[model samples]
Target: MAIHASPRVTEILAQKYVEPLRESGEFAHEIVESLRAYVDNQMNIPAAARSIPVHVNTLRYRLRRFEELTGCYLEDTSTVIEVSWVLEVFGRDL
Candidate 1:
């Protein structure tokens, strides 16, 4: 059976797991902005890079660095989903 999650539950999970990534000082504001945009766009890294006016490789490198700093892999489906939800719920606060 497929499991479905409520929006509130998703949001809560996001708050618990994702929001701290943005507040961390390990990445620059530009990198955080790029990551937020990418998560919002559903992991469209190339499009996010274009929006940020950075090279795709540069974006990838930044993302990798973020993962190293946070011990969270942005490319993982679960991590991406949580990060996306967090950005949607609290990105403006950051």
Candidate 2:
């Protein structure tokens, strides 16, 4: 919170991740929500899907598309941490 609120870091992080997701247009919210759910569920696809009440395949597709758009692989620990941090920074903004 300090880092995000103290400077332009919030904007920077948002530009790096959120903006690209937003480019997905109508699907932006869906993808972001899916990502939040996935991360919150500890990357457990089934759990994430159940939380979202979406099909497993649908969550999988959103995650895949998230990777494609952000060029960030969810399989990487650092990537997940970084993405999670970015998500935290934006929160409702996303």
Candidate 3:
């Protein structure tokens, strides 16, 4: 089952998350990268930091900003699961 980046998927994601990232500024990629790694690591902050090749403090800052921008909470299990899926679907499509 191979998936490709489709315009429809991208467009939907754009409305849900991408648009916010775009407004987050030039370093938005860092936030996305960190978030992907965070979810990949089962939402473990320290592991996410190591995976992102950044210090824990940096990742914390990005996560804070992510919550601020999205009104999503990393500490919440449901939010974490939702975000993980969003990242998975969004990445698979891309």
Candidate 4:
């Protein structure tokens, strides 16, 4: 028999993965905004930093902190998947 992934299971996993970040404080909010902007802009770090009005180093630092808090690197495959889900689900709110 072949195991198949279900939509309900995927939805649940997506929600579980996104809940913490959604509930986090201002830092997470900023990080999410920054990340979304970066992803939306095709992963352009300098452009994102400029758009967010922060220095590149500051943006990088915040991104590092975000990775630490979320225990997921923004560049990682799984994290990218989760981030994409979050962006799709809540992009308008951010």
Candidate 5:
């Protein structure tokens, strides 16, 4: 699980996916945090929700909202990969 570690790549990915979430305001952090948990939990809704200490329904809503806002499907490999990298690189700052 090696990141490209390219600053430019991170910047671009952040701009495309992560930035929008940030621009979305305070709730955006919760969304990104939920997404990170979702990915960390291997996309298992229950597991992710538990990890976040949130209700499954809440997590589901956040995920759905994320997809709706970003137009990036979690079920897509490319989206997941790019997002995973962005999370690894810029997640803390976001």
Candidate 6:
């Protein structure tokens, strides 16, 4: 709970992590699921797409959309760490 004491004054880290995402009208539960699948598959598009039961292109689109929404490129190590942390922390809630 101490993590909530950030200067940002957000709520739980997981909730805070997703705040901007939820504020984006384009955000969807599917995006979260896709993220989970994608990360779990080690960012492998083919495996993630198959796991999500979506086309690979669809998965790529979602990834691009996620980047657009968060301004965090999946190819970036820092962003990957941040997003993977978000997913690891809040994936169950999603």
Task: Compare the candidates by TM-score and give the number of the best one.
Answer: 5
Candidate 5 Cα lDDT to native: 0.86
- Per-residue CA lDDT of model 1 for 9-53, tens digit only, reads 766665555555557655556566877868766689888888878
Which runs in model 3 stand beyond 4 Å of their true positions?
Answer: 1-14, 92-94
TM-score of each: 0.63, 0.86, 0.74, 0.69, 0.88, 0.74
Q: Candidate 6 — which pairs collide?
A: none
lDDT at residue 86 of model 1 (Cα atoms): 56
When summed lDDT is taken over every stretch of 10 residues in candidate 3, the lowest stretch is: 1-10
Instruction: Quantify how close model 5 is to the true structure by its C-alpha RMSD in Å.
Output: 1.7
Arranged by TM-score with the best first, the candidates are 5, 2, 6, 3, 4, 1
Q: What lDDT score belongs to each candidate, Candidate 1 first?
A: 0.68, 0.85, 0.74, 0.68, 0.86, 0.72
Q: Report the alpha-carbon TM-score of model 3 versus the true structure.
A: 0.74
* Candidate closer to the true structure by lDDT (higher is better), 1 or 4: 1
Query: Model 2: how far is 60 from its true place, Å?
Result: 0.3
Q: Please, what are the lDDT tens digits per residue for candidate 4 over residues 1-94?
A: 1113355644664565555566666666787777776777667789889987888887888777767766778787777666766567666453
Model 3: per-residue Cα lDDT over 1-94, one tens digit each:
1224555654554576656777867767788788898888988889989986999999999989888887777898876765665666667332
For model 2, state the Cα shift of residue 84 in Å. Answer: 1.1
Worst 10 residues of 5 by lDDT: 1-10
lDDT of 2 by residue, 1-94 (tens): 6764645765666677787888888898899889899999999999999998899999999999999998889999977887787778777557
Looking at candidate 5, what is the lDDT of residue 66? Answer: 85
The Cα error of candidate 4 at residue 76, in Å, is 1.4
Candidate 1 stretches greater than 4 Å from native: 1-27
Q: Which is better, 3 or 4, measured by TM-score?
A: 3
